[model samples]
Target: MGIAEERITRLHQLAHEATASGDFDLAREYVRLARRVAERNRCGLPKSFRRFICDECDAYLRPGVNARFRTQSGGHVVVRCDCGATKRYPY
Candidate 1:
């Protein structure tokens, strides 16, 4: 990983820690900053990091708190956010 990727990884870790501590708002801010860093540096968030955030509400999903994970038919994975937004990924 290069410098930008390293920075992005660090930011994602911070967001995870913030969410774990029940400071969701802080986590959201961290995600926003991470995105900006990625954009400025011409990179994207790692695939694993992308799945932890709700695209609609920018919420950090804790897998049963603010988000629900379901396995759909045909090898699809569904993530439903508390904001009523759903994302389906074919895994």
Candidate 2:
């Protein structure tokens, strides 16, 4: 993998390890670093350019309720489904 990809992977690993160890403070720091690296590498597309996919219906998420971003370990999005299921998309 390229340097950016390797860095991103390391960031995720660190964040995961921190969380698994119950070191929330360290996890947050790792998450912050991951976000910065992702932003710097232009890995995540802009909101307007992003294509939301519903994990349940396999359809495009309609907008508002389907969108939520978290600066967690690795990137994650919480999507509220019409079926009353809350699905998390992680990358």
- Per-candidate Cα lDDT values, in order, are 0.89, 0.54
Candidate 2 on 1-91: residue-level lDDT in tens? 6676678677666655665666756755765665577689888522321234333443334434334434456687666645555666566
Tell me the TM-score of model 2: 0.49
lDDT leader: 1
Q: Tell me the tens digit of each residue's lDDT in model 1 across 1-91.
A: 8988998898889999999999999999989988888899988888899988888878878897778999988999999988999998888
Instruction: List candidate 2 segments past 4 Å from native.
Output: 45-91
Instruction: Give each model a TM-score.
Output: 0.93, 0.49
Clashes of each: 0, 0
Distance from true location, Cα of 47 in model 2, Å: 15
lDDT of 2 at 54: 35
lDDT of 1 at 46: 88
